[model samples]
Target chain A: MQQITTEGNQERMQRLVAVRPRLISFARLQLRDLARAEDAVQEAIEAAIEKDDTFAGRSGYETWVFGILKYKILDSLRAQRREGWWQPLDEELDEAAIDRQFQKNGRWDQEARPSDWGDPETTLHSERFWKIFDLCMTALPDTAARVFSLRELMGLSTEDICRETGLKQNNCWVILHRARLRLRACIERDWLAEEA
Target chain B: MFKMMMCKEATHLMSKRLDVPLTFQEKLSLKVHLAMCSYCTQCNQQFSLLHETGKQYEKLIERDIVTLSSGSGDSR
Candidate 1:
């Protein structure tokens, strides 16, 4: 009986090791702080191992670990919100800046028009494109980046995003919209239109 | 005179639909603009592609981070 339990513990330890980095990635995407992300991943892993037998194996180990990490990330977001770690700029100012990309008549500015991406299926498959995409995401203001991740990556609804980020509903929508426009512009100038 | 939505407002409306349901007036005005303007249509397509790229990029970054950390065995 002792040997069986020891072997089970060993197997679970190995599984946790395999999933650790991914858990950390998910956490960092939300927390945006390495130390906090590491702490969350640590707590999540320990929690998972402690409750090992309770897992019904209904999902893969990674999925289960991510489910736990999600809450941990939310806790960090809430804590940071309470601490007032974020000082979001006036959202209207941000929107006004974005509005300049279009003319007064509501047409795309000459510089801001969306250029044809030429066969998006192939562009999506290109590793280079993904690298540029990541760079653009990182370039966004921290709050905008976080909001975008919550909405696009986490698939969180706007209401939930407002709750998590402590942002008003309109603010959340404005930030998300601005992030998309800026990200699109970055990719166009730095990657696509560069060769044009 | 026909009421025309500006390109900036139309694009904002485009993104707003994702966050909340548009009012009937909002939806009608955007539809009118999109019908006349091919540029806003391209902008809408670009937004969709950006969104799709973000979804795919999330998976790639997760796997890449995992491999980088696991190879070094440095979770800290």
Candidate 2:
């Protein structure tokens, strides 16, 4: 029995290792802040160490960690909210709309391609966009921002997010909806509206 | 069923949940709303375009990752 338990712990750790990178990715997207994401992931790893035996294998190990990650993200957001690190949603939207109205003017969907058009590799692997994306992500709040990253950026489903965040379907939907709208508005104001 | 399960207030709020594409139920309500509200229709279009552009941007990011990994950014 002791040997079986030891083996199980070993398996859980291995599973945790594989999921670590993806978990960090999810947290980063959710928090829109890499340091915050890393902190959340570390918290999740600590929690997983405590409950490794409870993993029933009903879902992938990565999925389970994501569930922990979701909680970490929500906790982070709540903490930030208490610290007054949020803008009113309407204020964010109005600012985006005004920026869009001003910057877009009349030209829609006319973004220029990268300067070095022919090099697919250069475009594909450039860190330029990621750096800018990291900066703009700070504009997003904690949980709402994370939901969009998990769903939109990382390609997790509503169901997965539901499992992670411990939210019912309706609540998950609400978070996702709010996250997407805010991020879309942020991108419109910060990035897209900059062009002709 | 989705239209029935989702209310009018919820419908407008949930419209932004389409990361993949609009579902039949979502489409049904969206079509109804878009017929009356041009701004929402524009918002939806803008969302999809943003997604497409984000894909383009991801590529650029990956290249930078490679550059950093190889220490190429240090000098020629």
Winner by DockQ: 1
Q: For residues A18-107, could you state the per-residue lDDT of candidate 2 as single tens digits?
A: 556656765666666678878998999878877777875554455566567667877886675567664323222333432332224322
**Which run of 10 residues does model 2 chain A get worst, by summed lDDT?**
A107-116
Cα lDDT for residue A65, candidate 2 = 62
Cα error of candidate 2 at position A118, Å: 16
Q: List, residue by residue over A51-165, the lDDT tens digit for candidate 1.
A: 7777734545555666677777778777877898765443635566577688777678888888777677777777777667767877777888888878876678999987676
Error of 1 at A110 (Å): 1.1
In candidate 1, what are the lDDT values of residues B1-76, reduced to their tens digit?
Answer: 8767788888888888877899999999989998988888888877878667535644554465456446765443
TM-score of chain A of each: 0.77, 0.52
DockQ of 1: 0.38
Off by over 4 Å in 2: A1-5, A87-89, A93-196, B1-76
In candidate 1, the residue pairs with backbone N, CA or C atoms under 3 Å apart (3 or more residues apart, or in different chains) clash, namely A106-B6, A106-B7
